[model samples]
Target: MTGVPLLDPEIPLPPDFPNRMLTHMFASPIETDIAPSGTLLGLLQRGRGDGWLHALAAPRPDAVAALNHCVLRDPRPDWQLEHRSLYYARLYRELDAPLDAIGEHLFDPVDALEECEQRTGLALSVLGHLVTAGRQDALALLRRYAVTGANWRWALDELAVREDDAGLRELGPAILARFPGTEAGERALIEAVRDSFEPRPWHLWAEDPARSGQRERLARALEIGDFDRWQRQLRPPTPQPGWSVRAVLDWAREGYEQTPRQWREAAAARCLGAVAGPGDREVLLRAAVEGPSPVVRAAALRHLAERGDPAVFELIQRAAEEPDEELAQAAVTAYARMNDDGALRQARGWLERTDELGRTAAVMLARRGSAPDAPGVLAALRRVVRTRGTDAKELRALVEGSARLAIGPAVPVLRHIYRQTISSQLRGHTARALAVTDPTFASGFAVECLWDCEEETREVAAHHAATADARVLDRLRSLAADPAEQEGVQTAVRGRLAPS
Candidate 1:
């Protein structure tokens, strides 16, 4: 199968088109120049609601072919990131698309059992939606897949949402047969029964006389799970008031020696904070500086920083400069949390250094610095981008700080990150920064953002995109009328359309 040529929006593919060609078509970017809503393929790529409208209006065979390609292949880079299944399902209901393509795709011999869920999850979700829309064919197809498919648990859960007891009862033996009669299989079945998203089908099967053994196992597992949760709550390893500060520190050190978990040390720090008396300040200060274990030392620093102890600032400075990466990071985190003016002053002094501690100081200033600190934040953002590029996750705080401080010089860099970053969430943060800093945002990127895959990005566009362009107004109107549009987005659209 070869890729489909870029065709006119109105043109339909031949009915005999190959399935692999559809995959190739989606693998490449859409070639259309207009808004994604203008073409069926482009709309699908963007996962826009307009795709549903466009697909419905396209030639029936062509639309069905395109929709099947998407459901079967799973085109999105991240399925969890985009909204496609519900949109595709709604179109299926409107078009009454046949189930043959779906069945063939589900039963394809090439894909292994491991790949089945990822490949068919969207299609299964679509079928689930269609069944809810009262499509008998959809329900029957779901039942067939649940019994025969490798991702049967997913299919079963879908059916559980809409299928009645009688419809569900007939499938118990087939579903149960997948689990062997061995101990391992029984354990797997217990886990499946315990973790099921929808319990209706399991509940129904558990009551049946033929499945009494499976029912007893499931009930036992559920009881143990509940009791375990209760036991954990009743005897949590919290700090007691009678323990002295040294004992609390030793208790923390004991956990660190056994498991070496960072969070355990942090929890212990909170315990030390509760138990430490005024007379124990000097002892804690000494531990923060020279404790035997780095975990104990870091925890002491964190506790002292929280207490607003004056002597701890120099200790933080020393720890921040330490060669040990974990201790340094913990020190920087503690320094960032401090509310003292001296911490801010120290942050300003350290902003010129080019090491990790320097970057940490810049981030601290970006987060807590006033408007006067915009230049330093902008400098840190550019330095990180120039050195590490936009893919750095560490740039998130600096990106947000650049926006919060409204640094005009940061707009170009922010725009660069927005354009080049693959992360939808990062792009969202960039959009928000642009909304505040870019004067022309309403007339520029805001228009394109209306078709963004992330709802929050769309919400930002809705609130800020200039209504001057015909495209923006049309999209706003479409979003306002679509019941499936997020409530935050619709609220923004209404605010824009509201009579002044």
Candidate 2:
């Protein structure tokens, strides 16, 4: 229920779409070795607001080289999710950087066979921004890539946003050629039309005045795409666990038979809320604690813990210490789902332990703990910064909790996270927290935050940065004027302005 459009996972999607196999290997998070922060490469890698500032001060050749390296290599911890492309594109514009390096990277035939959006998404995104900024070369390159590249859809989506209606109309035949007359081809075309990240091009082609044949075909695709989406909305596929406790237990057993550790118990547990009754409580309790089926036992434990069943509270505490790490994680997650006073008390009790459950407990308090819980939350924040540093995923929850409680004492740690974390999202969270906890933020990070890589961070800066600083005023006015800035950031900038 993320509100994101999804293809039916039960049906086979186009093999060309990103399919992440669990068996596939991955490098560690942010493990790509970055140079010193003082260097241009490192600054861009970190996506720092001041990256361009450093680039401007460096030699033009050095700056261009660093910028090219970053754009081509993709320095993000997770390229699929990060926001470095627009930032890099802006730098490219500022530097008037050449497109040769980017062009070469985009067309590298060596990596063409293994077509993942991860390969060219950042480059295409940067080129998209450049095209919007009036780089005709970028527009032309994207047009060509749409025909030849493995990641052509990304290029097409970019073109959809910035290309002229005439330019889009010309591509109708090429896009149509992607599907042949076969049944599978038609379905693929329908799926592509359905799963498109941007629909403007499709919508435009469906009604092109001069191209009656293209229009008819595209119109059919649009009609079918809309119908498929509507059908999915009207009746979601049936749940595998069905509508009763016994059915759920049987489903869990079936899942366990397929994969010992990859059982359907967690999903089965979710169904228990609708069907379990007084008659089923003992069965659930027995399955949770003593059942021969590991899957049933796990599901029952999750259901009970999620319901905050006091009968299973001790089981939660003990299971978190189980020899099976997956079971321990499942048990701890169930414990965190509890929203009762007893859960809060349990979280408070575990504040001293540094295990996963202990950390989850600390986060629980940080999120839902009261005024009296502020001290514990602050202590937890400090301890995590000391133990795991600012980039730790755990810090995101704790930083938000600190902000929620307005814990002034947590300012130092929040400031540290803002300064040290290489993650733009984490830095954004820290910026928000520091706005409340740090009085000096208006004159300090707030000024630099105006130039931050992430739009949301800049939005926060706009709301809080002091008007007295000359840099703040200039940056805010620029952001207000910049068409490339997000609507939210521009709105925030406008809110802080005097009426012209």
Candidate 3:
């Protein structure tokens, strides 16, 4: 009834195990270390194929327990990125897993105050997948949580996608009650309406004849949301004072001091480009070499890089060797953005360096470099995936490079990455790549891709899944006519079915 019981009675808890991790846990991706890939927990957490194979071979209770532990604890440090819920949900169905642990975890008293997605996001997401898989209990729990759970917004999103109109209408009063007629409440309601992942429930509520009061409130919120968006668009960011090089430099220094994010430096660089003159070159160059602040130096580096300054490459190489990792990283990033002949040549040299500079160079070449660059891209892809796993930041570009260059050796690595990655975004991209490179795609992964949680994935499946199979036509037809389907997906679906 509390948190999920320790990996079934067949599996003993580790001696260091603390309380049900649902309570008294510190969740930070910075601290989340990768588990040993050979272990079932590691495999499941990483969304790897071996994890599923191991789970099936392990005692059913132990496998279910390990799974429940993962769902309740929320393994991924950045819960928002990399999607494991659908993957986990499929595992659950494969095992015909019980929902008692999931139910208990969602209802645990800790959920009342601890609504941060880090706490229960995985559980909620897994539940959504089960709901789509025709699990009534999962659907029921989502509805219940939507009213009382701290993370009601997420639950509402899950329900919006699959729940019936009658069921969704029942939630309007409970949800609306949380935001009263008070000014703060009104603002919150407006934002909620504006930000809901799916707008169907709001739209349905607004059209319901019986919920006149709810309809009016939703309408008012929508109108305010539209006005807010219009206002934001009207306010284009520009120099506070009429443009001057000194003023822009001063502005960058100030913005950097206030909140030194990389994006601010990039913004300042754009402003500097507009105001800088032939005479101002000395000052900009001086700032790039010996700036008072990192913001100024980074901005100057970006500006020089963008303008293709003859001396820019030297400046970049120098900064990259400097002690400040931040500036060094900035320089490398700036250099990576360049696509001209010199930059491409420089990238070839970087392929041999074993640092972040080298990593970004591989990504750069993967994205824009020619077919001859395939060997280098393939090598980087294998090395990064081996050392850092599929979730590495460079994974997408590496996969794309493989497909673009038609790197024959990359198919194995791509397939491994597709199997191991927790990111639906990454998986969808891999699917796109595989459609081009993998000979087995149409009859293999593409068939199941149609049932994937992400619509982009479904669209990919629609385009490439072997139409010789009977189910392919059925799925395509269903997608073509489904009002909830995305426009791009519908286009693919209709194209596949137009002849029939």
Candidate 4:
């Protein structure tokens, strides 16, 4: 009663063992056959075909059940008891039975140690096998074993490799904290923490128990080796634990959504940079069309074309047809980087579909060889700037490069934006445009910019002034001496004003 003997009297404990393990020993070895249950067999197959027991090929479920029942009903003989008990343990693990159920019929640690004066070798073997099997139920069973500080070393080491990240982290730390001197104990502890943050690619699922830790693992993986692991893991396999395609997409979307307005633009940019694949193309296309931020939408549009996706051409055309000038401009920029007859035709068709302002934009973009110019492109650009509310900077910049091509009526509009615009930046740019045709016109804007309040205007003015006026040196010298002038303004004026 004290030692809680399990097998027949002929059966005895293996020689040379500690006593405490006997307390938790089984009294009656449970029955199991050479062949296990179908569920158990299937579980083994799923686990890379390795398991605690060798599976029987084409096993008879009835024979297995009969053998299992016989073992459970009778006390195993002395010589066969060790094998019998071990077999029972294996069956229990396979069937996912509770360890305490086995323990309740077996030895109790305190009383067994007082009477037996030796550990049960049978119990040790069962525990060791469970640790190595790495099955979830096996792990649960191993936790019930008599875990002395000495036994803790082997147990912790095995757990580090066989258990999931969370389990290893838990058991490994307990071993190290309780048995600081044992090398295996200490190593297991460190490995648990290290592997949590830097998981091996083959075993990401093994590390998912601690999601924050798993995230840390992913981040560390990205830094380790050109991110081949991240790229591989995140790619097709349809779905896997740590780096599934859909999960990554969702993660990036979440970040973009939660970020502050100022930061959302940057986050979306980074997300787009990281996410590019066939399936992701639609997501990016939708973002290009309907993203909340212009910056995000523009970048998505540009990258689609940059990625050399043929589908982007149609999307670009669709965006070009939108009433939003920003989207239209982005699509135009993307179109410029592309070369496709379809895109050109689409852009032209959309342009023809719009009224004067959009028509002018389309014609300006089309004239650059993007599409065949509508017979009316140049004339439309002129009319838009003259009578429409087109931005002067835009009209002038458009006219600057194209005016030399007998751009017709747009030339006068460019001159008008140049002379009438209030923005020195626009005026200076328009002036430079005019300089491309008539240097005198550029010189006039240059003088006007010099008298302007904005430093940028003065800089432009000085640059233009440097190209004109025989008395330029005198003008700069006089300006440099003026006490009212800022040092930067004086220096700029002096630099451009060559000495007589």
Best by lDDT: 2
Candidate 1 per-residue lDDT, tens place, 1-500, comes to 00112332322223322332343354312121212223566456445434555576689998888777767766555567655666677677678889889888777764344553676787888888788778888888899889988788889999997898888988988888878888888777767876788878877887766677767765665676556557777995865534688887777677667744534557867888778889998899888888878888888999988888878778987998898888888888887788778777778888887877678788888888999999999888878776665656667788889888989888878876765454556777888998999997888778767766567888999888878778788878977987556799899889988889
Q: Against the true structure, what is each candidate's TM-score? A: 0.70, 0.88, 0.75, 0.36
| Candidate 4 structure, TM-score to reference | 0.36
Question: Which stretches of model 2 miss by more than 4 angstroms?
Answer: 1-31, 36-38, 234-243, 259-262
lDDT of candidate 3 over 1-500, digit per residue (tens): 01111132322233333332233323342234444444566657656434665687899998998788778777664566655787688789889999999888888898776746677778888899898888898988998889888888889998998898998998888888889799999999999988788888888887778988888989998888878878988897754634887777778777767734434577787888788878888888999999988778888998888888878888988888889888898898899788788778878988977777889889989998998898899888877876676678898888888888888767767776665565657877898888899888887768767766566777888899898867678778866765545788899888888876
Better of 2 and 4 by TM-score: 2
Q: Mind giving the per-residue lDDT tens digits that candidate 2 earns over 1-500?
A: 01111222322222322432222222322235555444567667778776766786789999999888777766777676678888888889988988998888788885477555776778899999999899998888899888778888999999998998999989988877878978999888889999999999998888889889888887898999999998989884445566789888888777777744456766788788778987888899888776666667778899988777888778877778878776677788788788888898989999888888889999999889989989988887877766665566778889999999999978767766665566888888899998988898887777777877888988999999888877778888988888899999998999999776
Query: How would you encode candidate 4's per-residue C-alpha lDDT over 1-500 as one tens digit per residue?
Result: 01111122322222321332233322333321112112333212111111222233225453244323323333222223213333444444445544443333223444334332122333434454555544455465445442442333333443445566555445432332442445664454344434342333214432445546444443443344344445666786322222433444344344445646222333333445565667877777787777665555666777777676777766776777787676677677766655555554554555544443355445445345322363345545554554443343345435544444544434455555543332334444455555555445434445544444344445555666645544445546755775544577687887676465
User: Against the hidden true structure, what lDDT does model 1 obtain?
Assistant: 0.74
The true-versus-predicted C-alpha distance at residue 75 of model 3, in Å, is 4.0
Shift of residue 298 alpha carbon in model 3, Å: 0.9
The alpha-carbon lDDT assigned to residue 421 of candidate 4 equals: 35
Please estimate how well model 4 matches the true structure, expressed as its whole-model Cα lDDT. 0.45
lDDT-superior candidate, 2 or 3? 2
